[model samples]
Target: MEEGAKHVVTGGGPQSGHCRSVSLICRPLGMKPHVVIEGVEKREDLGSMGNTLLYRMAGSKLYLAPQENYESFKRRVRKMKQYVSDTYGEKCYCIPVGGATGKAVFAFISLFDELLQQGLHDRFDDIVVTVATGGTSLGLAVANYLTGSKLGVHAVTIALRKEEIYENMDKLLKELGIDSVKSADILDIIEGYVGERYGTATEEVLSFVTEVSSSTGILLDPYYTGKGTMGMVGELVNNPSRFKGKRILFIHTGGIFGLFNGEMDRVINKEKAVTNDITPWLDENVSPVSIEQ
Candidate 1:
């Protein structure tokens, strides 16, 4: 964006992290953020919850539109941009759905550079990350190709098909003036983890997420990280030889807020025993401290 840009626009599903991030970033920069939500018809149904609540808290303007197609959504965003300019007399920068543009890929490239700086570039044999619009994984793949590292980038597809992600990667490659290399050659797209489509999770998967959070203290949302974890674990369980001696790093992108979006009730164990017993902690070596004022 230019120095004095007044408004920004982006589009995605209701719980899109990218849209929420844009709102957060824009607010701190004195720029107003506008989000064009997909498949939403009424404002009331959008509801103040999940990423939607975060967007509102950041003072983002919401525009609901139908998910007819990608091109149609783009057209609607263009119209929104025009409206912002005409109505407010200021330029509005529009971000594509998922921020899956060529420029956005560089953000992950920088992230990969940070990993190299932290001496983690060669510590892992495989990197597992969740993929929706594919920008993040493409950036990592570009970094891997540039650095000549041998680590594999496994992108678990939670929404789009493999071909769709590949297409997005190819477009990004063109933006970087690269040729003679195909996206599939550098990126591994993992599928079959999207249980009931995007933003939907089965009870088994949710239970797995609960178990993981309880054990590791890392909360994995059903939308992305949970599915990515399942895909990685499935690979290791089904084909142990592939990761027998290799160290795998699963990228835990933060989507914890989605867990509070009111779907966890289906996975809660109502019959599980709850206890507040502290007798086990009281031993002969244990003592309490006394303070005097």
Candidate 2:
């Protein structure tokens, strides 16, 4: 578990969402994650979330990654973490976004297994999945690989470079013992809706998420689900007939806690808090009428 892991925290970004969930679950089992952060201060929520997780869940505090762009921030964090790990001789397993190939593949297989068992698999013409680290997307791509392209398992790039993403998917299949499905075979990458960069959600993006939440009671975190859903909706809305016989099923991997970050909180709810103008502070009004201390 220590080879790919470090004490450092990286939950602020969308790709880091999966990492956060994994760390939280594994922390109680004596795995204390600690590392230094450097330049990753693009959004208020990223900082707030990192610190909040450290305070409530672990014995250590969060370190800010250096203030570089998303890619550079990741690089700096990785280098610092390696330095610490090598110095202290700590081991961490660095699984990719969907817990590597086997897990990712099985996740989709299991999902579709149940759906197919329930007589629900034949209803969809397409399955829209998110490709953050190419974990789950690659898995579903495997499923599509098995289906011989009957079920359109298209992945939308929410973060990272699309080229590397497809490559990762190809590698994941190879790791999963599926030798035939190449990148070009099982890859259908949709781009242009990442909202600037990782962990950064645009105003329009938040609006759609809020609307979806209000209407369906299915909350979507901004980074992963929000971006993927927005992309799917935009495509379907703009070109209805393109998928006329197609039933689009958008898969939402759970990451609700990521929504509590500062950036998300800012746009999630604009309604004022319920209050009676109740005095929240002690009477500093005793300007001249104060008793001797």
The most accurate candidate by TM-score is 1
The clash count of every prediction, one per candidate, is 0, 23
Output the TM-score of candidate 1.
0.87
Q: How high is each candidate's TM-score?
A: 0.87, 0.73
Model 2 stretches astray by more than 4 angstroms: 1-15, 35-46, 50-56, 60-63, 67-85, 97-103, 240-244, 264-293
> Model 1: per-residue lDDT, tens digit, 16-44?
88888999999778899999988889878
Scored against the true structure, residue 67 in model 2 reaches a CA lDDT of 44
lDDT of 1 at 233: 91
**RMSD over all Cα atoms, model 1:** 5.7
Give the C-alpha miss distance for residue 218 in model 1, angstroms: 0.6
| Candidate 2 lDDT over residue span 1-293, tens digit each | 43444444333333355555655666666665543333344446334463346344555334555445444544554555455567668764333323445665787777766666755457887778777777677766666667566676777788767886766666666677778658656667778888777666887887777788877899887778888988888878786554425677788877666567666555545543121122333567744432222
